[model samples]
Every structure is written in structure tokens, then in C-alpha cells.
Target: MSHSTVSIIAQCKAAGLRRTKALELLIDTLLASPRPMTLAELSEHDNLNTQCDRATVFRLLQRLTDKGIVRRLGLHERAAYFTLLLTGRHQDFLICTDCGKIEAINAQCPVHALEKEIAQKSGFTGLYHELEFFGTCPKCSV
Candidate 1:
């Protein structure tokens, strides 16, 4: 879901964090982003660079990750990408390698029964899942 500055500020408050200029910029950029963004992309965004550097971006990402405000996706051998999770929807992705687009696919547990069986057989607890599919998007495939 696209977000506005007021909502972002509220999110910060909900996360038990204070609002700062840098955080504002980062949140704004991520909320407006069309797809998951890498550190390089965050660094290059004009709004975040005036006061934020690599380390600051890293710190913000780490903090947000811990707060469950964002999720990281590993795309092939490329830099890890972060997508904001403000909507609180747990979903996977269809990543387009050629165009760098990240589209969220609704969560469907294709291996639900397998997970239960595996847990029972292996005596493991709290099993979870994450999935991603990568290839050229239609625009790029053409």
C-alpha cells in the first residue's frame, strides 16, 4: 500500500522510534518505490543523500528489519533488495531480472501439508516459508 508522510510518522511512533529527517526521507522513498530497492538504489535517491550515507542507510534498514517494517529479498547474485511491509501482508514475489521489477504474489501455501509432515518427522517447531520466482518480465521478454 502506498503511504503518506503522516502515516509514516505514525508508523515510526508505533515502532517505538522517534521521527527524524533522515528516517522521514527513507520512509518516503521506500513507500513511493515501485519495487524492492537495494542499498545502492537507496543511496542514489536524491532525497536520502543530503544527510544520509551508506552507514546511515544500513542502520535504518537494519532497525526497520528488526521491527518487521521491511523484508529483504535475495535476488540471484545481485545485491539484496528491501521492500517495505507497511501493509502487513506476507507475500512472495515474481522478480523480473531484466527490468528489476518486484511484484508481490499473494501468499498461498503450496507446501502446507509437506511442512506439517516434515515438522512431525523431523521434530522441528515453528516452520515457516518464503518463495521467489525470477525471470524476464513480459515487458523485457518482448
Candidate 2:
């Protein structure tokens, strides 16, 4: 198994989740994707679809999300997207409003200080943020 797969499995174990084929396939699919994926996209993946039903995928995602191993990103679209939460990795997104395309922003986050300030003032620990910028892409604007 790949290192990411192993790590995901280990995370699941640590989260008190049992290892199963469907869960492993879902983790693999998430790891292979370049960007966050909607439920439809995940359910349609060939390897995953062949092994498990959509409900199973949904349940597993919910469990992982509860365990902080997966993050659900809410865009303007109807479907929410999900991605694996890697340690010490933070990203923001630029989304094309017309085409529903998502692009990762690699620059340093401007809101880190704001989050820290909020945490300090509120005495909240483990504070983080998700940001999305929406605009028309070149093709959509043309």
C-alpha cells in the first residue's frame, strides 16, 4: 500500500474505526484525486463504485469527517466537496462560478492572524479557517 493509504488506515484505526474494503477504497480514491470531490464524483469512481454503494460512501465520509480525517468544503454549488485533511497543510480555493471549477491557492493565508486573534480573544483552541473566492473564469467571461 502507498504511504498515504497506510497513514489513512492508521488514522482510521486511531479514530476507533475498523478497517474495511469500502473504507480503504474510499481513502484511496480521495488520495488519488487532485482536488476536493463531491459525493457524485466519489460515487462514480470506477473502483469505488464497483465495491460499495453510495450510501456506504456517504457513511464512511461522515465518519471520517467526524474524526477530522476528512473535511467538507461548502461551495456555492448544491453538492458539498470533501478532501483528506493532511497534517500541517492548509489551503484556500479559487472557484469559477460559471463552470464550478476549483483551483487551489498556494499562497500564504491572509486570515491566519485573524484566526489567531479570534482564538486568543475567545480562548478557543484548535482554530482554523476555510476560504473560497468565486469569480468567472476566462472562458466563462468570454
Candidate 3:
């Protein structure tokens, strides 16, 4: 089992939440998915493993988000998708229009230096930022 999976169970237990089979399945599903998953998509996953209700999944996901174990991405005018955050991976999302797919990208962003430069010029400190890019993906465009 992955450390994240173990940590998730520990977090839930620490928070006074029971680690049900449903919750385990939910975690497994999120970990297995290659992209972010909307609540609806999560409820309807073909795996048919999680016996948890949509609301339960939503609440658990929110808890995970609070703990920084998941990142939420708002896709254009629709419900947000939850992406599990793995240790040591800085992540960003790319959403596809036609298929409603979410892709995670991790790159060593040099923009951090640029941000520092801007902060120095502007006399701002203790600052970090969130960056997002939107466009038609190559598969969607084709």
C-alpha cells in the first residue's frame, strides 16, 4: 500500500472518522484515476466498489482537501474536480472540453523565480501563488 493511502486512513481516524471499506475503496479509486474526478463521476465510477453515498464521498473529499491531501480544480462553470496530491509532486490541471477529462501536469516551474523578482520589485514578502492555464487539448482539438 502507498504511504498516502496509509496516511489517509490515519487522518480519518485522527479526525474521529471511521475508516470503512467504502472509504478505502474511495481512496483506491481516487489514487487509481489518472485525472481529477468530479463528485458525480466519482459516484458513478465503473469500479462499483465504493458503497459510500455521493454526499459521504463529498464530505470525505472535503476533509481530504482541508488536510491538503487533495486539490480542487474548478472546471469552467461546472462542478470542481478533486485530484489526489502525492508527496513531492507539484501539480496543475488541464481539462478537456469535449470529453470532460482532467490531466495533471507537474513541471519544475521557473515562474517561482519570476514571482520572487516581482515580489522584490513590488516590496511584497511571504507570498506564493496559484497558476492555472486553460485551452483546448490536442486530443479535443482533433
Candidate 4:
């Protein structure tokens, strides 16, 4: 079965979400962005304001997040950022405390074995996890 797909509208339809301008714009923006973005950043997106207002964006983000089409990343105490939950893609983060810069690692759970062991010991089934490492990035470290 072939599995490479790129249409966010199709992806939302498969997820049982109706395609709307706000949803489409948000999905398109998130998919194109390299890093997660805060609400202010999203509101200020070059192409987004012409399509939807800040409130519309906020509501769409909530709905997308609830539908598991998007992910809400609590990067720091200041603001929560948003990213898409695309198929066949996963990333963990390395945040710089000094500069507040973020680096997304392509690694998917470098601790799967450890997670399995912990699950067995704790008698938990269907275990899942979230891992984010915060430290000084190379630029900040130097």
C-alpha cells in the first residue's frame, strides 16, 4: 500500500474533520513551519491574517488540538506553541534555557526500551510518553 500523502485537507477529512478556511490555513501554516509557533507568532503569520483573525485562529487551534490533528507544545512558562501531528513524522525537542531557542530532534523516543521496562514494572499497558530535553544549545553554550 502506498502511503505518501501531503494534502492537509485530505488529512483532516480522514480524521473526520470538516475542511474550513481557518482549519485549512492553520494546517497549511503549521505543516510548512519548521518549528512550533506561539499564538502571537501564528497571529502574525504572513498569510494567515488575510484568511482569519486571531480569535478564529485560536478556536481552530483548540479544535485541531482536540481532534489530535495538531499538538500543543508547552515550550516554556511564557506561552504554549502549536505544531501539527503529521503522519510518519515525530520529533522531540532540545530547548535552550539561556536563549529560549528550540531545536527539534528527529529522534523518536530514544528511550523506548526504558519505557517498556518501566511499563512492565508499573503494570501499565499501552504506555506512551513525552520527552523534552532543556539545556543550552551550542550557540548559547559557547
Candidate 5:
């Protein structure tokens, strides 16, 4: 298991969630994935498909999302994408409009400072932001 996965599992335990087989598999899958996964994609994973039903996956995702262990990316596509939310790790994505490919932007997040400033001004705690850029990828443009 990865450090992120272990941390998330610890968080789940702290939140009173049990360490089920399905939950463990789901976390492993999400951590191994290079990008955010859709419900269909997650359900179709070989390990998860055999062990748990689609409904189980959906419910687990919902619970994790509620607990801030997972993040639902509201991209332009009809399907929602989910990714694990590692502590102190933030990322932005570049989404290809034509092919629907999502790539993590390697640059430092420019919005963190702004988010802090806004939070201080508004007296809000635990403020965070999600940023994504939409454009045609080179493959799609060709």
C-alpha cells in the first residue's frame, strides 16, 4: 500500500469506518490509477468487479467523498470522475476537450496563496479550490 493509501485508511478508521475488503480494493485501485476514474471505470476494474457490485462501489465512493477522502471532479463530461484526496497534496488538471483526456498540471498551484487570502478576508476555515484547464490536446488537434 502507498503512503497516501495508508494515510487515507487511517483517516477512515479515525472516522469510524471499517476496513472492508471492498474498501481496501477500491483505495488501491484509486491510488494506482494515473488519473481520476469514473463510476463505470471503477466498477469495471478487474479486482473490484469480481469482489463488489456496482452499487457497492457507488456507495463506498459516496461515503469516502462525504468524509473528504475522495474528490469528485465535475468535468464537462456527463460522467463524474473521482480521485483520492491525499493530505497536503493538491493538484490541478488539464482536460482535453476533444478526447476527454485528463492530465495533471506539473506546475505549482497558483491559487493556493489566493485561496488563503480569500479565506482570511472572508473568515472561512478549511477553504480549498479546484482548477482545471480545457483545451484540445495535441493528439486530438492532429
Candidate 6:
């Protein structure tokens, strides 16, 4: 198994969750998705043949979130999406309303520089930030 998968399994185990059918379904669903997915979408995946209830999905999401295997995006007060990323390769996201696409933007991220400036100005250290930009994609513009 891939290191991330192994890590996820280990994390779940450490959190008092067993490596069971539900966990396997959760992992497979997250890996297969190219973009962040909401719990509703994940639970509805046909291929999983998942018998686990919504509560199981929620619990697994929480465990994965704590482990950093998934990054959470709060779209609104009511809904959030969980996206997969390689560890340490964190980047902001741009969600396209038209095509339901997600684009990662990392080049020349001002957030990095801003953090440095903030630290220099405030005499603080060891800080980071999360940034996400949402808009209609190119195809949607036309």
C-alpha cells in the first residue's frame, strides 16, 4: 500500500478506529476523487457498495481531518468539502462554479510573504495561513 494509505490506516488505528470495511471505503473514495468532496457526495458513491451509515462517514472524515490526509474547505456555514493533497505540498484552491472544477494555485502566493511580513511586524514566529479563491472558471465565463 502507498505510504499515505498506510499512514491513514495507522492514524485511524491510533484514534481507536479499526481498519474495517468502512475505513477502506472512505480511503478509496477520497483517493479516487480528483477534487475535494463533501460528505454527501462521498456517502453516495455507487462503487463503494458501502454499507456504513452517515455517522460512520462523519467519524472517518473527522479522523482523516485530524491526520492531515484531507484538507477541509468551508464553503458556507452548512457545508464543507474535503480535498486530498500530498503531504507538505499544500496550496490554495479555486473552485469553479460552472464545471464544478477545482484548480490549485500556488505560484507567487502572497500569503507566504504576508506571513513573513506579519511575523516581522509583530515579532512573532512559526505561523502559516490558508487561502482559497472561488470563482467561475474560464469555460464558465463564456
Candidate 6 lDDT score relative to the true structure: 0.73
| Local accuracy of candidate 4 as per-residue lDDT tens digits, 65-114 | 88777787764565777887766566777777776676687765778789
- The whole-model lDDT of each prediction reads 0.79, 0.88, 0.74, 0.75, 0.88, 0.73
C-alpha lDDT (0 to 100) for residue 4 of candidate 6: 74
lDDT of 5 by residue, 1-142 (tens): 7777788789999977889999999999999998899999999999699999999999999999888888887555557789988867798988887777778899999999999999999999989888989889999998
After the best TM-score superposition of candidate 4, give how far the Cα of residue 107 lies from its true spot, in angstroms. Answer: 4.5
Q: Local error of candidate 6 at 88, Å?
A: 2.4
Runs of candidate 3 exceeding 4 Å displacement: 1-3, 15-17, 46-50, 96-101, 111-130, 136-142
- The residue pairs found clashing in candidate 4 are none
22-52, model 2: which lDDT tens digit per residue? Answer: 9999999998888999888999899789899
Name the top TM-score candidate: 5
- Cα lDDT of candidate 4 equals 0.75
How close is each model in CA RMSD to the real structure? 5.0, 2.3, 4.1, 4.0, 2.3, 3.8
For model 1, where is the 10-residue window of minimal lDDT? 83-92
- The candidate, 3 or 4, that scores higher on lDDT is 4
Looking at model 5, the pairs that clash are: none
- How many residue pairs in model 2 have overlapping backbones? 0
Roughly what TM-score does model 3 have, to 2 decimal places? 0.67
Error of 5 at 115 (Å): 1.4
Clashing pairs in 2: none
